[model samples]
Target: MAAPYLPMSQEEMKKLKWDQCDFIIVSGDAYVDHPSFSGAIIGRVLENEGFRIGIISQPDWRNTKDFKKLGRPYLGWLITAGNIDSMVNHYTAAKKKRSNDAYTAGGKSGRRPDRATLVYAQRCREAYKEPPIIIGGIEASLRRFAHYDYWDDKVRRSILIDAKADLLVYGMGEKTIIALAHELQERRAREEKEQSFAIDLQGLCYVTDTVATLQPQEVITLPSYEEVKESKVAYAKAFRLQEQEQNPYNGKILLQQHQDLFLVQNRPSLPLTTKELDAIYALPFARQPHPSYANQGGVPALEEVEFSLAAQRGCFGGCSFCALTFHQGRIIQSRSDESLVEEAKELVQAPSFKGYIHDVGGPTANFRQQACKKQAKAGACRHRHCLFPEPCKNLEINHDHYLQLLRKLRQIKGVKKVFIRSGLRYDYLMADKKERRRRFLEEICQHHVSGQLKVAPEHASPKVLQYMGKPSIKVYEDFKKEYEETNRKLDKKQYLVPYLMSSHPGATLHEAIEMAEKIRDWKYMPEQVQDFIPTPGSLSTCIYYTGIEPRTMEPVTVPRTPKEKALQRALLQFRKPENYELVYQALCSAERQDLIGPGSKKLISPPMSQKFKNRKLFSDKEGRGKGKGKKRRH
Candidate 1:
């Protein structure tokens, strides 16, 4: 059965009768040979290309012994920091060390070093002096340009330069990795005796001393690294240009000066066609973790998605806080219904198969095809968004394809139910004027929902939503009423879980309190609270660091001081006993003492400790004397 899974050890290599590997993929995540994992996807893609590849997952980075376990590769090394950025994997939004890693075996934390891409590359070089290294995945892709490092508390150079890797594949790298493997094989053969090779490929980035080797008007030089570091305006301008140039068809070769060297990013890789996506998902992935991890509780990361199918890729919703536009681009590509149905048949045959299919969606659940017909031939507009502020007039919203796929899966012999747990873009669902949109929502509520349907109405404040590239609160409100009405007709009590974020840039104490009030109206205290963490190369990060909107260059309200950040976050969960002190101080700071008393309008009651009397800040009155919230402009 094609050896069940790719070779992860030398004994497996011996069983395959392969003398050596062409590439050794080193990753920071424990090896889960499933399509949901980038390392597994890359390994399978390279293997399909006839390159003997092996995975070195979560190796010890402080020394070279673990990396040398795979021996030397004939071609080079392909490295990644797994599906998530390393720093994010290690630290919480409050900069506290996370106690568990979902991607690791047994959910262990601190399994790998911070900045794992750079660390893994160094280990690879130490293990084999002359082996070429290429880095990708979320860490290196988003950091391909010079970006502000939140952990380091300063602007850092591109990871291509910092990692000292030869090349970086930026986005959904299925196509890029296959093409890169073939090219590297041919080029390395051609220049066998040379010191090293220079790679020039689309959808890849590298540092160069100069930009002389380019066609006129093809290479776009951005603000230098030093210039962007010194001036917020320059940084905003550079970020805007980077966003504009992500389209595969219309994008230009982007360049930026990093001291004397230039960090060059080529146009994004063309999205996989349906045939390509079909073949990719169709790869014999074992559809589970490697058997070796069975002793360590398997891979916890695969629990939710082990049986769930990835129906599509890319998002057109264009939430500013999201890095999808940079990592996966705005183009929506999906697999054929037949291919997905075939997978369901395979899914049902598994020994551990449950009657319930967890999910069948991607970046956004309802997005199955391109936003509009013209997007495929031309590209997503550089200056405009697909669904933000409002849906584009040209938007083509249809859920028939997705609904049909779901219907087919539901009819499968062994399948009792199918769920759509992946997030649904509420605005997109509301944007469709057709009846299918309503039917889609009904179908989802009736069959797909596992008790609760999840949607992101990030905040109630219009200004905060604007900064977040999300629609106004009115959209969510209208959708909620309709959803309730739909449930009323069906005589079901399905609920909606609204995903909320706190401390987002442009959301101060005032806006957070407004959101808390909205939560109060809904009578929902969210179980999962997403405190905004500014990861690299996102538009929201630009505003968070520079205090200026990247696209507009307007002054923005950014709460950077640790005290302000904590208070804003605390206001969202004002009812929590531990947040009482922080929330009390925030209400006092904002001069809205009305929200702190024991009144029906209050968010939290005062503390009952004697220390309150000892300290002058805590009072027995506790807003007994009413005070109004100060008026503020949007």
Candidate 2:
């Protein structure tokens, strides 16, 4: 029989007729027992392995009272800053406090403290010092190495050191966590001290006192923490080295010095096989926020994913701004079609499932398979990208499996519509054979699209796009024309919504203005714009801090000041009245004052003055019609 939601309290544990939990997961988000949320997946996975699991979600960090709610676990404490990094969750790219946190029950802010993994780990230790604390999730995964912290504006040491965690798991940690669990269980069975367990597990990072025990040829030593903290050049070098060794097949152990101790990261865990992935997703999940949140409004993050299916995991698109390469890795790991169909049928049985499947893709919707055959045997190429400046000749671009899966999903009884809300790599699509590409686009426009399809073109400037690891703007233009033509053929009035970003590391005012002009030509006013945020563990963030692209070590322009960033962002939405001044300043700064005028080709209209305005415009037209007895047309 499937399990109920993992016990969140001692009373729930007692109700289940248990004296203690084998492990307690402490997270910074509300406990939503859904596969989409990490806490639930970890808890359910452990439960499947016959371990008693309890969760303490968004515990108050001010004291150990909440952390001690579950009492001491037999295994240890698993820590995470929820689905997202706590700092990123709390603040915007501009360092402004966010008004609502979707992870929290009531969409309220300030539920989790800053650097939540660190704080949560500290509290867990304070609550019970004997058991080991293992940290994972986006926060720990990205910050496992010494990294540039955007919030601090300086290099921070590896999170494992700061959090004082015994071990840190990186990437999608299903396989790694299971390994750790079994090891801990064996140690407990043998009555061994947790600290005495020598953990050299893959996809894990730990601090050791010496490298003398490690084989010299099996390890790659990175720059010391002091070196990276003191020099941008060293930081870039360190980032470059770490990125190169990410391949699980050929990757070696990574070691870095943090003052007196050595922070060691084992090679990444192997990607899960299709059968393994299917089994993991098939694990029992209640697929709802814990009922305790009934009054406070359930976790807002679960809404989008409640009825959706995560078709696959990982991306090989290699966008410089994306963190998937670090977290989920570049290799694609997908579940079997049978598993997905079964899950979709389950959704149909739900009372609130309104005949719609919200989404059916992972990081990149169209990426249903590995980039090439070589990836399966040898792992992803360390030095080159599958899709970047140009699609690699070895790249295998196909959408037949995805199309078949979608067809099956939409045909499911009571599932009226199946949508593809996740990002679609148009460049990869365009690289496909003409007939297949046409068929896929036609089917998408005819069946999948809900009206507007959202895609990320990111920027219009070639230089900026290159820095972003995105294809040329011409690629997007080609794809856009093809998309529109496909919709026209199907007699559907569907449109494309292009996602644009502003103030990326390599973008100057010139590039920003160029993008603004492209937006003008497209007659599209984006409601929301993405400002390039320097999140940890991304190539773009490395350039944002070092002022040099790590790959080439060439200096790149970086927009660091708030004023400059504001100007760049304003240019992306120059049509807005609120952006007038900033847009004007940007135009002047670029020496393109011609773009600021009353002409149709101009980006913004010149500022209006009372002296130049027509007097009749300000006249009381309403009063003139009312008082003079002139009737207004209805």
Candidate 3:
């Protein structure tokens, strides 16, 4: 009934009884028709509009052979670098090549090129130069501006220039893509070669040779590409200006010069209403990886999300390291409870249904509405965060709607458990009235948690927290205490897994040592410690490249070298035997040798081998004698 997964090949298209596809989507991910996959969602949305759509997933970029699989489309070609930025997907924070890609079949890597969007766009041009090329998704969205590229270690030009795409869609592109599709359809019917495609559409960017015709009042010009490329101060200023104009209601057009060409970005598209969001999720989705991938063990990325429900979209937490503000924007758009419950019924009927729904949430699971009433009309405040340095007094801290949705989901027939796996903004939760917060925590601990609830406190240093745009460690501590107390009353043996990070901007060795000390006091061994990766289009990445916080224009210490990053990361997990040497060195460097001894208060025990003992690892007079006048490494 749904044309069985959007005709990935000509044979499939023939089976659908369609002569030609209205649009073709090319993605770096394996074809997974689930709502969680962006390509699938776009394809289905187009199909729902009575337009025939085809998709080519993870095509061979070496030649035009694979790109020709879907043939040419009647409307245009939509290209994306899958769910992740291709560079981030291929490399680690240390720039080491990754061996596995969850979006690929059999968990293998190298299926897609390093910059998949750019590669795919070029191949599309090679195959058919007539069709208009459009680039979107996480890769193109974040790199839409001339910003930092960790892989290249330099500021790259806007992706629109590199990809040579006719139009670049930023943010969640459901509304923007639909509008473009209709406009293309109208142009095709008219046979109008003179009428150009609309460049004034919201959430779209285009390149032009001149800005002489543009109105000065409607456009705000950022520092030119050459200016930002040469000056860190100019780069910071450009990022600040871009962030300020992100609001859809009051935001103005942004223009940036690249050599002789100008990149014009229209204001963001408005957030979708509940009714609109509900219809999009309810669109007929096959809700699984294309049957072709069954033999290759399917796409690993879909495993966890197969039975999960997406209750909402967008986040307002404003973590500096996250690109949600750049992609999904700050306003929250949620689906109706009836829609979620109906989807749950369908999941229960699947043959692989396990009686458990793995997750039921969005970017921030508990965030189900706009931050405040004003956000609906005025859009999110441009210069301030809702719950960062401190929760705004006007911030609406309510979890009632989310609780109702979860309750309704758990009540569905044949459903065993409904877990909230998405990250919960504990600061926002803690800001709620005590009774409501307690009730929400109690319900989650009693019914939703699957033995462990993962919350991201990120770091413990106040300086790093401020740079990260996160609440103080005190907020996390209060939430942790309340959570433990709630589990105690419920007599559940659940634990809190705090997501920790290291080597973020503003984190010197001293701050790293401070975090290690806190971990020591809490007696928590972080199983995983994320070393900050400076992916494109995040405030933290901008600061990493410029050494200046865009918001304050103040310099911050950045852990850029491999040695410093390693030492800082080791400090978070000092208990690991493999990290003993690095932790000892960090302790000595931070003048925190007090933490490397054989006591319960110490973070790690002194090295047992003579090799480390013979080195002058400490600067203090007491440990100087142990080295026997050997030169100190520090």
Who wins the TM-score comparison?
3
Give the whole-model CA lDDT for all candidates, comma-separated: 0.85, 0.90, 0.90
Which pairs in model 2 have colliding backbones? none
Clashes of each: 0, 0, 0
Residue-level lDDT of model 3, residues 1-634, one tens digit each, is: 5787888888998888888888999999998988999999989988888889999999989999998887788889999999999999999998999999999999999999999999999999999988899999999999988988998999899999999999999998999999999999999999976537888889999999988888899899999899999999999999999999998998989999999999999999889998999899899888888888889987899998999999889999999999889899999998889989999999999999989999998999999888999999999998888997899999998888888888898888899999989999999999999999988999999999999999999999999999999899999999999999999999999999999999999999999999988998888999999989999989999999999999889998898877788889889988877677677788887888788777788887666667765454344443212332322221
Could you tell me how far off, in angstroms, the CA of residue 82 lies in candidate 1 after the best superposition?
0.6
Give the poorly placed runs of model 1, Cα more than 4 Å off. 195-198, 606-634
- RMSD of each candidate? 4.6, 6.1, 3.9
Candidate 3 lDDT score at position 146: 94
Error of 1 at 8 (Å): 2.2
Query: Could you estimate the TM-score for every candidate?
Result: 0.94, 0.95, 0.96
Instruction: Give the least accurate 10-residue stretch of model 1, judged by summed lDDT.
Output: 625-634
Better of 1 and 2 by TM-score: 2
